[model samples]
Target: MELKKILCAVDLMDTVNPAVEYAKMLADMSGASVSVIYVISSRSTYENLQVPVEEIAKGMRRIWSRSREDMDAFVAAYFPGVDATGFIYEGKPAEKIVEIAREQDVDMIVMGTHAREGLDRLFFGSVANEVVKSSKCPVMTIRPEKKSE
Candidate 1:
């Protein structure tokens, strides 16, 4: 397939390099541009909280600023010398990931999965699973290698 753009979804909470490496490899082979998206899942929680408007605004700003920094750092570390766009969105992570993939009209979506099964999957709610089901483009999920304890 002729790939012009790739969407890389990162949680910034787990091991993010592995998935990014796959995306970068694909992009290198297909000459595609990469867009990294980090979705903030705490927006709804903040909105539902009984907090002052000013406090909520401050909280939101803090989250946005920190997310931006993290996203930039991730891109720089994983995609050095590559032109990658980093984006931050607020809302449900799975929903945002699918939405951005559609909006960007990406050729492929790459992400990392915890590979949770059974009760763990149900309790954690796999973002990779949701994106795979919801995205129109091809989805590639990478499960990080287990760290040696």
Candidate 2:
């Protein structure tokens, strides 16, 4: 299919790198503009830093700045010359991804899934599963193969 726009939701973990790669390949094949979204999961604003608001904003900015650079590097290496946008938002990951998909009208929602053990699944939960269940558009999950195991 012709994918004009794609929303790639990343959790900024190593395991999710394959999802980014899969989206890059699809975008390369379909000539789609890629929007890479990373959700901060909305912590309590910030910890008491004993600093000014400007400083806090600057800190947040720095964090996002690094994220942008990292994503840019990955995109450049994989799918060069494709128009790309990276975003950082604070909220529940599944909700933010769905909201961005609705707002941007992306053709596909791409994300990653981890094989969770019993207790990990019990506590941390599955953001990918939630997104798959709730997203307005089609959700594509890429489970990268494990090398050693």
TM-score of each: 0.88, 0.78
Query: By summed lDDT, which 10 consecutive residues of candidate 1 come out lowest?
Result: 140-149
- Candidate 1 local distance difference test against the native: 0.84
- Number of the top-ranking candidate, with TM-score as the measure: 1
lDDT of each: 0.84, 0.78
Among these predictions, the greatest lDDT belongs to 1
Count residue pairs with overlapping backbones in model 2.
Answer: 0
Candidate 1 contains a number of clashing pairs equal to 0
lDDT of 2: 0.78
